[model samples]
Target: MSEATHTTEILIVGAGPSGLALAVDLARRGARTLVVDRAAALFPGSRGKGMQPRTLEVLDDLGVLDAVRAAGGPAPVGMVWSEGSRQGELRMFDVSEPTEAEPYQGLWLIPQWRTQQILLARLRELGGDVTFDRELTGLAQDADGVTASFATGPEVRARYAVAADGGRSTVRRLLGIGMTGETVDPSPTLVADVRVPALDRDNWHLFPPAGETGFMAICPLPGTEDFQLTANFPDPDTVVDLSPDGIRKAVTARSHLAPEDVTEVRWASDFRPRAALADRFREGRVFLAGDAAHVHSPAGGQGLNTSVQDAYNLGWKLGAVLRGDADEALLDTYEEERRPVAAAMLGLSTRVHRGEERRGRATQQLGLGYRDSALCVDTRDSIPPDALHAGDRAPDGHRGGVRLFDTFRGPHWTLLTVGTAPATDLPPLKNVRPAHIPPYEAYGTGVFLVRPDGYVGWAGETPTGLTDYAAAAGLA
Candidate 1:
């Protein structure tokens, strides 16, 4: 077979949740991207079963909340049981205040496969169709752009290439990035989807069967009469079995009931959680995002959520540099902002394994943000509670027909300036957006600037560093 020649404004390798989410983000911003996946079809197994509230906010921004809501992501009312002896009863739900900025206070538990389907559909609608069965064979990056080759297709020259592939990413290996974190044996658990005859569709149950191998968590699927359970079996050496007999035995053993109590088994799988992260998140025109960038124990179920956020963080930087809105320095912020987050998360995930540490019961929802970034100064004290970023997400309200984030637009020179300057007095930040904060003695409080992908940009009390801050934010 001969090689073909193709080019995209941006090239995204990996069709998993992160890559697809990023593709949609860029395509929505009018940046053309081509996503390549080695898989022939979307994986159907329920790999991950939850989406954090932060991720739900991202999906809402993409204008697909209704679809996600339809895809079995209802309000998160979950429970947990401890020790062992199987057969768990219902646990209490931790309720939180739901805001327009965060419509879903809890994780909308949905299978990973369904999440991908929703993202893929959105990508297609946005014109970022995935090229299936096309594996990235080789990659080479230069000062100007990166060149990516596929197994049986053409070479693609994109302004930048992002590797969102899984833990053992070929891109990471090809780029010679080292894995710095530890990888040890993780707690083994079994996950399955079923329809139990006697189980009702209300609360979650965790059975603490004896031997202390770990208990089983059983709960009714939010949208279906089918139920799901995560149980730790007695024999650590026993290979995870997905066969009907294996499923029956595992469920029966955990639920402490007869095998006949369960009928239809829709999904089954085994998982061992571990933590790992790439020593570097970027190398020239090639960058890493999602699982390719970091992998950690899913005890907190944060792998998918962090990966998606990584993509969101990188998407705008890439687009900015590509569209002449920002400079090369902007991309460096990816590693600076995200690597620390992954490290912090890895540490926190390790804590959950201790079983002795006590935390707020709402265990799965994560609140990872760069509020203390060196590049950002808290203008939160200056602003009232109604704003998006008192160093948080930029709030959007209706402006004419196109609901907008008031005076927020980005990819460069976000003049997060305060102190006496009228909106027009702000320096002309080419291709960047200017957000005006009515001056106060506290000054720019709760009014920090956010980069296009929503990380803290250059922040100061005096609305200072207008030019230097821009340079730090990838502006010329």
Candidate 2:
């Protein structure tokens, strides 16, 4: 047969959360992207179900927050049970109220499949879709671009390619990238979505380990009658059975529910907890993203959140470089900024898995930023140490009848002059949206330049160096 050929600006492997989120971001920026997956359909399991606050904000910018929120709900209180009696109530996440600066609070619970569906919908709305059953078998890159050959489809050529195909990433292995880390848990765990009509939807039912058995929990998934069941195996060599009868037996053996109560097994899978990070995020024009870049233990629910953050961080830089709006040097900051964050998150997830850390503010991921990156520039010398700095996430608030997030919603840079004014002859910056807000303490009365990804890129008491930074960074 003749070889079919296709070309695009960017080729994204694996239509998981990271790939889909990246495709959506680039789509809104008018970038050409092709997303491919080996699987014939979207992931069916509710594997990663927690959405951190920072991820919610990222989803808000992508125009899918409403749909996601509607499909999810706040994490329910954990109800502990002993035999057939109630033990106590456990708080799964540290709850906090929303503030003017941070509009999203607490942890939102949505099945991974639902989140992917929402992002896929948004991507299609932006005039892009994923190509399924395209298993990437070979990859080659040169000075110009990267070429990929699939098992059953056409040869694809793109200026850049990303690997978001989970921990067992084909592109990563093809690039010879090493994943260095250790097993967080030696014992295997089983995660499945099941339908149980006898279970109540008010609380997340939990059962403690008893004798040879292990701990088990069942959480009601919002917007559906299905419940996510997670069970641990204390023995390292224990084999998990994924069959419907096997799942029902496990549930009956652990909880007070009977085998007949488990009406249907929707989806099921098993794995041993591990935390690993890629040796590097990029090799030439081929980039590693999401679980392909970093794998985290599911204890603190950092895996999916960090993966989405990777996509959010890289999407804008790729779009800028592909559109000739920024220099290629900007791409280097992706690994520089995200690797350390990933390492930190991996450690946090391990600690949570080991019962050494609490899933509180750290797991929320709102405090993560690129403060030490080369792209950050802060000219103010006397500002308070606790105040927002140049590389921090821009706060959300309304001043002078202008909401900051509303101004920063699209795929464009934002220039906020907070209780400050530029000089009369200030140079004009291209593709930068301008907004004036009265002195908001969150920003500390300065001129802040926000990147397309919503992080403060440059801040100064005045716009003295704004134009120069913009021109040098290729944002002009």
Candidate 3:
């Protein structure tokens, strides 16, 4: 830590979904970014088997949706069973008309590993690379920049360094950030990705004939010749051999099938749900996002989706600060806007893990928002009583016949006109582009001004100064 001399606009630690997602944004903005991970290779397993539509939107922005779509199969049509009979199909449908505002209808069941591959491939395409065996061993943030030493012996000096590591993030620990939450011990379950000849296609059939040992599985793997079986292990301490035979035994024991009928074991592991978050997301020029910043149960299949969105919230702010278009204060919004979401996600994850239903949930879907945001005005009155709540994201509904998405892209800002000031009323900024729309004229489609990162800037009605909406975007 002797005043190491390395430099980059930004340095990202960890190559998980969060790190890679931020790298995708920063590199896209032409920010000189360097990403490092401790693992030599990406995770190779079936973790986070569900992908919500919101995540698909964020991935689409990063330009990897197609790759992920091609590599993975379709959204899971949720299933529930008790005995040999279907108890019910969890209501997992779009229920809304297709519009640019929000196109994806429900969650898809693609394993997390495929997502990592798609993101890594996209990062490479953007000229960004993740150096592995490179760990963040030390960090020191002064007035000028953040100096970090890598276990690899090299050092990096970045204007801003992000710790997207994980629950036990070395950077978060080095910075002395603490997470708050309790660990929920569900029945420890064994999950293995293997190929059993006659298995798969019943695709996620939860078994045990109602009273036996509940086991769920048949996750389809395209090129691989196997199924991913998830079963409640009688003993949490016992490790599943993960061999072909071990998996076959688990599958057959629960499904009452023939032993030889199962063949070819591919991969396996055990998992338990946990919910937690760092005491803070930012510490000087160094910050944290993703699992390194927060963790929650995989309930409602929100884990990966939440982490990716966390990076999504932080990326543009990091890029803007690096480019000198915005102050470091902008970075403050990451935690402000995302903390609540993560906290809510933790609850949703719990609900999902417990098999909760998702019907006409609420505007919080994508409607999750930030009233303290710089872009949102205080005209809370005009905000239809049914519109949204303080920490809720403004609905992606149409306003003034414009798509809330696609309309706001890249580094430019927009003036969301809803009976408030027009884009013409806004002052000149090198990157901000004003867009105005009337509120009453704007309904089901009210004006929802969004930043490049996808958080609400200003919603509801006319405010004194739209830039005031922007200043609060992060902090003063």
How high is the CA lDDT of each candidate model?
0.68, 0.92, 0.68
Overall local distance difference test of candidate 1: 0.68
Best model per lDDT = 2
Ranking by TM-score: 2, 3, 1
* Candidate 1 wrongly placed segments (more than 4 Å): 1-3, 74-95, 99-104, 183-187, 212-214, 224-226, 356-367, 371-422, 431-447, 460-464, 471-476
TM-scores for all candidates? 0.82, 0.98, 0.85
Best by TM-score: 2
lDDT of 2 by residue, 123-202 (tens): 99999999999999999988999999999968999999999999999999999999999999999999999999998899
- The stretch of ten residues in a row with the least summed lDDT in candidate 2 is 421-430
- Give the per-residue lDDT of model 3 (tens digit) for 1-476: 44556578889998888888889988888989889888888877767666666777778778888777776665444456554456665545445644544677655556667778778888888898888888777888899888888777678888888998887799999999998987665566777776666544644555643454555655565434545677776555666656767767777667646678765555677766678878888888888888887777654566677788888888887777777667676777777778877887777666656656453343125655666554345545555555553334433545567655556656555556556546454455456655655554213333445567655665544434555655555322
Q: What would the per-residue lDDT of candidate 1 be over residues 215-334, giving only the tens digit for each residue?
A: 676766666666776777555566887877777787666555668777877888776667778899998888888889887765566778888888888887777777776667767878
Q: Which is the winner by TM-score between candidate 1 and candidate 2? A: 2
Residue 223, candidate 2: C-alpha displacement in angstroms = 0.6
- lDDT order, best first, reads 2, 3, 1
What C-alpha root-mean-square deviation, in Å, does candidate 1 show against the real structure?
A: 4.6
